[model samples]
Target: MSREVAIRVENLSKLYRLGQITTGTLTHDLKRWAAKMQGKEDPFMKVGEENDRTKKGGSDYTWVLKDINFEINKGDTLGIIGKNGAGKSTLLKILSRVTAPTKGEIKIKGRIASLLEVGTGFHPDLSGRENIYMNGAILGMTRHEITRKFDEIVDFAGIEKYVGTPVKRYSSGMYVRLAFAVAAFLEPEILIVDEVLAVGDAEFQRKCMGRLKDVSVNDGRTVIFVSHNMTAMQSLCNRTIMLERGQIKMTGDTDTVINHYLNTYVSTSSTKVWDEHESSGNDYARLRSVKVVDDEGVAISNSFIEEGVNIETTYQCLEEGSKLYVSLVIKNQKDDLIFISSSISEDVWSMNPHPLGTYKTTCKVPGNLLNDITYKVTVFLIRNSTDVVYTAEDIIIIEKTDPGNNRRGLYGKWGGLVRPILDWRTIKL
Candidate 1:
């Protein structure tokens, strides 16, 4: 027995003009003309540009995705990862048939359902039920197929009450719920999901992941997922693809691809200082500097497993008698939360209101508690526990190089979020 190929993309490339790509298709051009003659906005016109943000693009034309090639096996889930302007979403759009490639062709075996972005493939005035039937019909499913899955979709979305409301009036979270439900439940052979799931809350994210696992494992459906959440990606995907500057940077197993993507893209920093003009804060307070130091209180980017880390943050108070508390949430390379250390929990600044001055605080993280991996610090400053003064995600990266685990075994890497040495007492029996 042999596995079947579900999707085959060959030399796929998409060229776009700076502001908008003019449709070269004759039928679309005629449709635009007809729409204009009818005194309505041209339905063919959509506004988007190539994703390059590194510098001012020289030419008016750019290849958003170029010469990309990959093959997905049936019943397999592929995870696509890249930074901004790296052509992650563009690839998904091309796969979902929301857009066409300028050069090459994509050979897909069966029907495709995609939730590319919020409110995509949905009409503004139509109810959720209408959209489900429409999507099913578009995917070549009959009305019976849609009707059989209607209640399941509604229950999964948890929007039974709002199913009658127009999707345009729904909140962003509601929009994603309905969109994902329709795409996942309507039974398309291939599922193309974008980062729209990021809009959902944490619990919904877990539920969606579970559903995705079932679709791939039990139903033998192929899926392509794009997200910035590495933990979800690692858990759901058997294979991974990384895109960079409209090119396929790497395609391999999940671990290798994720590690390469993170290590190649991780920023090396022990401190981040913001100038007043460059400050991302408001009038209440502003961040002065945040640094990660070693055991001796010296700042460094690279640290060993035996040596602990000390994180320090400094902020300048602009208003007098303003209450500000700082905290740091740490995560590993896979975006797994290790722990959160807060000034309020440490009884440092929760009881006092600071005057207009510079305040510096530090927290010592013990060694041998964390596995050797890249750690990121998300900084948060809150007032009254409701108002967020300033919050920065992954502002500082602490690279922990493990010298050795001292374990005598064939296992090369320790498996867990943290590597804490547990206390054990043995009694002779």
Candidate 2:
């Protein structure tokens, strides 16, 4: 059996004029209108460059998205990831029909309820209760249908006391909560959410994630999610697409796409070194180098999951009697922090002050402890156990490969941020 497509985008592109809202002067608009009447392409569409914000282009036009083609299958959850200004919101808006694409077409099979931004569909003068019904009506839900879900929506949003208040007076968090509740409860066939969820509290965010997953899994609805939180993306989306400068750079399983984005777009390396003239530090201490090493103390960027790796940092203390300690923060490709270790736990040097001299701190990460993924290491130097003196953020990147030796015959991708070989025993009852 073949899967049905929920949404199909073909040759989708969006172009915008710089420093102006309208397309251009009335004369340009007339020319575009004439071209449309003549069944010819717009004259200005061929003059713009890709939407690269860093570089200066000669033309006044820029393509926010170009040649974008993709399909979302029914009941599939899709994630869109990219750096800032990568045209993520533009694509979502186009799909939601909030804006028209400059060229190409998008065919959608179901009613789309979008939570694009805070208060996107809510009326400021209207009460939350009124807005809920209004949004439902816009989604083609009957009054009876909206009435049936009204209580559940208000209850889920935790705004029972303020449901009758004008939404303009609501806090940003409340606006998001109620907006999300309305969008999710309206029973739209397709749901589109942008990074607006970040405005809510952590608990509310978790609730939204749970609801998103429930709608896709239990209700068989299609979902498109956009977020900078990699951990959330990994947990919610089975497949993901990475956008670079308004184009799809890669699309595949969540793990593969996320790993590629982290390794390729993110600036990281296996080793970071500062010369004698340039270093990262204050007046008290200076960082010289940070790197990942093998058991033999040789620098290596790649290692097997079964072979533990070591992180080493070298620094020099400029002042005598400086109470300093080193700390290491390890994060996976999904940008989820695995663990943080500090030398302040040491018994001898932790409490005592240090004399002026060069020092090396090594943290041993045992094998079978970390999952097979790319890891970024950040080094922190603290003085007097409270003040952070020097910091090297994401300076060292390490890739851990799964050799299958520790799989114990099991196959497929292992779950969790850490894959430790814990002790387990079982007996038949």
TM-score of each: 0.66, 0.63
**Model 1 lDDT, full chain set:** 0.81
lDDT of 2 by residue, 20-115 (tens): 646456767898899999999988888989999878899888999999999999999999999878889999999999899989999999888887
Instruction: Summing lDDT over every window of 10 consecutive residues in candidate 1, give the lowest-scoring window.
Output: 42-51
Candidate 1: tens digits of C-alpha lDDT, residues 1-429: 689999999998887766554664555568769988999875633333344766666555577887899999999999999887788888888888778887798899998877676445578788888877776676567899899999998899888998888888888777777777776787889988787667787887888889989999899999898888898899999999999889898999988999999888766687898887875568988888899987676889887777788898888778888888888999876666788988886665663688888888888888877777778898997766667889877889887777774565546777777777688799999
Residue-pair clashes per prediction, in order, are 0, 0
TM-score of candidate 1 to 2 decimals: 0.66
The local distance difference test score of model 2 is 0.86
On lDDT, the leading prediction is 2
lDDT values, one for every candidate: 0.81, 0.86
Best by TM-score: 1
